[model samples]
Target: MALLTVKNLSVGYHTRKGFLKSVQGVSFSLDQGKSLGLVGESGCGKTTIGMALMGLLPDNASVTDGMILFEDQDLLKMSKKEIRQVRWKKVAMIFQAAMNALNPVHRVSEQISEAILAHDADISEKAAMKQVESLFDLVGIPQDRMRDYPHHYSGGMKQRAIIAMALACHPSLIIADEPTTALDVIVQDQILSAIKDFQNKLKISVIFISHDIAVVADVCDNIGIMFAGQLVEYGRIEEVFDAPMHPYTKSLLASYLTLDKDVVQLNSYIGETFDLINSTTGCRFCERCSVAEATCSLVAPEWVEISPTHKALCYQCK
Candidate 1:
């Protein structure tokens, strides 16, 4: 059975003008110990999906339709208290901003320990601290620095600390949102390596959300390409990368610079951006898609299955 399965999920935010649809009819499944990456441009609803899965959407955001099935149980149906109990114990989140996630007043180890105690009430404080020390080792932080303040750590260390906290509860799944946001290239590589290492060693499932295609390509086993609040393409990394069916996926690859390419090629999708506030019956990406058909602006595009493992949302691709 799949560890996580999200089906036809639609989420929107109530704005002054209208409801801004952030995610629409997105569906995917992840098996145990596998990693799936959600990649797209800004305002493409990548992070919103992650937030919805974690049950951390803001006050304005509402899940209009969908089923968030984690281990065959609907997360959407869980009450606030049920969610609180399940959150750190079953699913943990490695937030985007490391500095903001960590408290400046407490020691790094203390915060992680508190997370551990909150989930497992019977665990002694000493035992929790011991586990935090072990987590520090797993994430490559020195044991001596466990008691140090957040300010003492660098950007990479802060990220590692957050990852440690996420794993402190020994959850089955972890949602990482832009984990390497402000780090340099070298640090980013280190962070990615650490994530891969623990993911393999611990055998934990991960939902990686990032705008950086290369980073997602590096860490994820499967890739889901989102566009204008919809999943435009989804498949294994090689499947989608080798034969991208959607124009948006092709455009994303064209814009990104990979070492495999000798001569860099960039395709600029020139058109009006889709308005999230307004609902569209036709293809939302029709206006910006380079190879869009004459009927694309009037008709909705259905998912075209290229292979058993690969598919895209485009009539032309069909």
Candidate 2:
């Protein structure tokens, strides 16, 4: 069975103008020990999906429809206390802005140890610290640095610490939201490698959220290309990338620089984006889509299966 299954999960925020649909009918599944990447442009609700899965959505945001099923249990139906128990114990998140996530005042060891103790109350501080040490080692951080503060650590180390915290409780699922943002290229590669290595070694299911298509493809087994708060295409990374069926997905790849592909006209999808607040019927990506026709703007596109494992939310492309 799938470790985590999100069925038509929709999220909206109450804005001054109207309710903004941040995520609309987003559905996908992650198997044990596998990784699923949610890739899209900023403000497309990639992070919102991750936040929803973690039950950490802001007060203004609300889940309007759909269910979040983790291990066949509906997380959306859980009470606050029930979900709190599930949060760090079963599912954890490595939030964006690693530096800000850490407490500058607390020692790295204290913060992670506190997290472990918060979940497993029976575990002593000493034992929790031991687990933190192991996690630090697992994420390739030196153990001596555990005693230091977040400010003492470098940017890469800070990210590693955040990853370590996410894994401290041995959660079944980890939702990583833009974990590689604002890091040097070398550090970014290292962080990606660490996430992948531990994911394979520990048999952990991961939902990696990123705007970078190349980065997502690097660490994820399956990929979901999101746009305007919906998944445009989804399948095995190779299948989706090699045989892209969504115009937005193709545009994302075309915008990405890859050595294997020949130099092609870069499709810079510049211009006005789809209106999230008002339009609810037509396909949101139609305005920016390269192959969109008159019918695309008039009728909403539905998921068209191109293969058993591959699908696209576009009729024209299919």
Candidate 3:
């Protein structure tokens, strides 16, 4: 069975204007030891999806409809207390801002050890400290530096520390929301490499969320492209990157400036921002889609299969 399955998940935020639908009917599945990347432009509901999966949505937001099944159990159906019991022990999150997430006053070792002790009460402090030290080793942080406060570590090191804390309970799944964001290219590469190696070694599943298509391409096995609060395309990394069926996906790749491209090419999507408060009945990208026709404005597109495992929401594909 798939380790995690999210079906027909819709989420919205309550704003002064109205209830703004952020994520609409999004669905995907991830098997054990595999990684799925959620990529899209900002305000496309990418982070909202991650927050929903982690059950960390704000007071103004809610899951309007859907099922989040983790290990065949319905997470959406579970009580808050039940979900809390499952959170760090079964699944953990490496939040977007590691520095902000870490306690500024506490030493890194204490913070990680506290997570370990909170989940496993029987584990002695010495044993928990040992586990923290081991995690420090795994993430390539020196053991002696574990006693340092969050302010003592660099951006990359803080990220690694957050990764280590996420692995404290040895959870089966990890939701990494822009874990490498705001870091230099070299530091980003290092963190990605470390996470990749750790995932392989531990055989853990991951939901890697990022706006950077290149970063997602580097770490994910499968790619799900989101736009205007919907999943527009999904397929294997190579398939989606090499032969993107959705116009939005194509535009994303076109906008990305890769080193191999001999000619300098920059492309931008031309249209109004996505309408969430007063959403249209037709395709959300209809206004911006370069190839959209009259029918695209009148009717929504269904998922059209390109291969057994690849599909895109486009009437032209159908």
Best by the TM-score measure = 3
Off by over 4 Å in 3: none
TM-score for model 2? 0.97
Per-residue accuracy of model 1 over 57-162 as CA lDDT, tens digit each: 9999999999999989999999999988889799998887556789999999999999999999899999999999899999999999999999999899999999
Model 2 scores worst on lDDT over the 10 consecutive residues at 262-271
Ranking by lDDT: 3, 1, 2
Cα shift from native, residue 33, model 3 (Å): 0.4
lDDT of 1: 0.91
**lDDT at residue 153 of model 1 (Cα atoms):** 93
Per-residue accuracy of model 3 over 117-225 as CA lDDT, tens digit each? 9889799999999999999999999999999999999999999999999999999999998988888899999999988998999999999999999999999999999
Give TM-scores for every candidate, taking all chains together and pairing residue i with residue i.
Answer: 0.97, 0.97, 0.98
Candidate 1 is scored at a TM of 0.97
Per residue, candidate 2 scores C-alpha lDDT tens digits across 95-188 of 7755688998999999999989988879988988889988988898999999999999899999999999999989999999899987889999
Candidate 3 or 1, higher TM-score:
3
Ranking by TM-score: 3, 1, 2
How does model 2 fare in lDDT?
0.89
